[model samples]
Target: MSSPVILEDLQEAFPGWCIWRSSAGRLWATRNGRRLSQYEIDHGLCQTIDADDVAQLAEQLREQEAAERAL
Candidate 1:
C-alpha cells in the first residue's frame, strides 16, 4: 500500500475521528463522543504516529505488495 493507505489503515486500527455529540457537536476522537479539542486530537494523532514510523510502515507495505505481485 501507499503512504496514504498505510496512514488510513493505522487510523482505522486505532481510535478514529467520528461524528460526536457532546458539549460540542462534531467529529471527535474521545470515548465519550465529546468533541475533542484541537489540542487533544493533535496530540492524540501525534502519539499514534511518528513520521519515521509512518515512513517505515509505508516502505514495509510497499515491499510486501511488490513481493505479492512478483508471485
Candidate 2:
C-alpha cells in the first residue's frame, strides 16, 4: 500500500489546524481544536479535500491569515 501523507505536511498545509494519522493509517484533521477523523482524505471520497488539494488549501489559508493580520 502507498504510504499515507505525513502529519506534519498536512499541518503545514493547513495552518492553525491539527492534522495527523492514526496507527491504522487513518487521516485526521481539526479546525476548531477538535480532532475529526477524515476518512474521505484517505479513502478518496472528496477530491477537493484530498491530497491533491493541499496546495489550494495552503493558499486559501495563507490568504485568510493575511486578511486576519490586516485587521
Q: What's the lDDT for all of these models?
A: 0.38, 0.46
Residues 1-71 of candidate 1 have per-residue lDDT tens digits of 23444445644533332212235422222232445456654543221222345445445344433543554
Estimated TM-score for each candidate: 0.32, 0.39
Q: After superposition, how far is residue 44 of candidate 1 from its true place, in Å?
A: 34
Compared with the true structure, what per-residue lDDT tens digits does model 2 show for residues 1-71? 22224556656555666555456655544454433346533542222232234444455445545644554
> How many collisions between residues are there in candidate 1?
0
- Using lDDT, give the best candidate's number: 2
**Residue 70 error for model 2, in Å?**
0.6
In the predicted model 1, the residue pairs found to clash are none
Q: State the TM-score for model 2.
A: 0.39
